[model samples]
Target: MLVLNGPDGKFVVDTFVAPAWPRLKEALDGLGNAPVKCVIDTHWHFDHTDNNTRLHAAGATVLAHENTKKRMSEPHDLPVLYRGTDGALAGLHFDPSPVEALPQQTFFDTCKLQANGESLVLQHVAPAHTDTDIHVHFENANVIQMGDLFFNWMYPYIDPSTGGKITGMIAAANKILSLAGNDTKIVAGHGPLGNKADLMEFRDMLVTSCDRVERLKSAGKSAQEVVAEKPFADLDPIWGNGIINSEQWVQVVYLTL
Candidate 1:
């Protein structure tokens, strides 16, 4: 999550979760008691949007890509295909968000916001982590909040059910790289803050893994077969420690393909 203190008031990039509301509220209060004028949702995922209701109630206008509003406005079950604690394939469910938690204002390609005496460029990327992903670029600050588009060192969860795709993920990373300079601070959806180099590494990992998985699938390998082969063995030690493990990452890529 990122907070921008501009001339007008405070603008938040993404809300972490519902449980983190008190801490978030405190943080906002610490900012000289500025009102939250705007709250932006990078995507429709609960992790990034759970605090919408509270923030909106506090006089903030929620902004997000149209696709995000669509997803949050309805009941949907997000897929969770991963190895269980007992080594069995497992799945999970996600209910729809409340109406109060949904975005009130949305944009298509891009939207510009003038706040705190600076310009915020919110650009909607193609279906990447989710169809609703958007990059928040603070022009004067040279900081970019990449939502879930950049997972830092981990394998990203591509929600194909909501229009996420491996190729789109690559494209989204490239889009950030194109706009970023060496000094730009990148705020990832997860993990520590990063820079251009870290973003590059993430993009490369996605491309390399996607290529390997595609090759194996082309050779008639099933998702489980591809997982058993450990196609991303070289990258696992470095990028598989986060929420998404090797097998889970392979499954997501395969299912999207």
Candidate 2:
């Protein structure tokens, strides 16, 4: 999550889960004691949007991409996300968010804003991680917040249920690379902070995985067959140490293809 002290009040980029609000509130209060004027949702994922109600109740208007509020208004079951305690491919069931937590203002394409004495540019990408993905670019500061598009050193989970595409993921990275310079700071949705070189490396990893998975898929190999072959064994030690293992990563890539 990012905080920008605006001319009027504070501008928060995203939020943590509801349980983290007290610590979040303390952090906000510690930063100049400014009221939150607005909160931005990078995407509709619960991890990024669970605390909207608290901040909204505090009188902050929420801003997000057009699809964010829509997605939040519906229920979702993502079996690819996890398995139940039974150890089968069952997903967590999500209920619709309360009306108070919904975004009040949304933009279709690109929106520009002036906050913290800096110009912020928000742009939508084509369904990379999820259909609601948007990146916030702080132009003057040369910093970019890639909502879930860049996963840093780990293999990213592509959400096929919401139109996530490996090709779109590649395109989104190129978009950021085009807008970024060698000195630019790239804040990823997960993992440590990154830069242009780090982003480039991550993009290359995506390309290699996509290409390998596509080849197997084209050769009439099932996702499980590809997983059994362990095509990504070499890349796993470096990139598969995250929440997703190599086998699961192969299935995810294949599904996107």
**Maximum-lDDT candidate:** 1
Pull out the clashing pairs in model 2. none
As a whole number from 0 to 100, the lDDT of residue 44 in candidate 1 is: 92
Instruction: Note the Cα lDDT for every prediction shown.
Output: 0.88, 0.88
Q: Estimate each model's TM-score.
A: 0.96, 0.95
TM-score attained by model 2: 0.95
Question: Runs in model 2 with CA error above 4 Å?
Answer: 81-90
Native-to-model Cα distance after best TM-score fit, residue 79 in candidate 2, in Å = 2.2
Task: Tell me the tens digit of each residue's lDDT in model 1 across 11-115.
Answer: 998888888989889988888777899999999988899999999998999999999999987777666665634353335467778888889999999999888
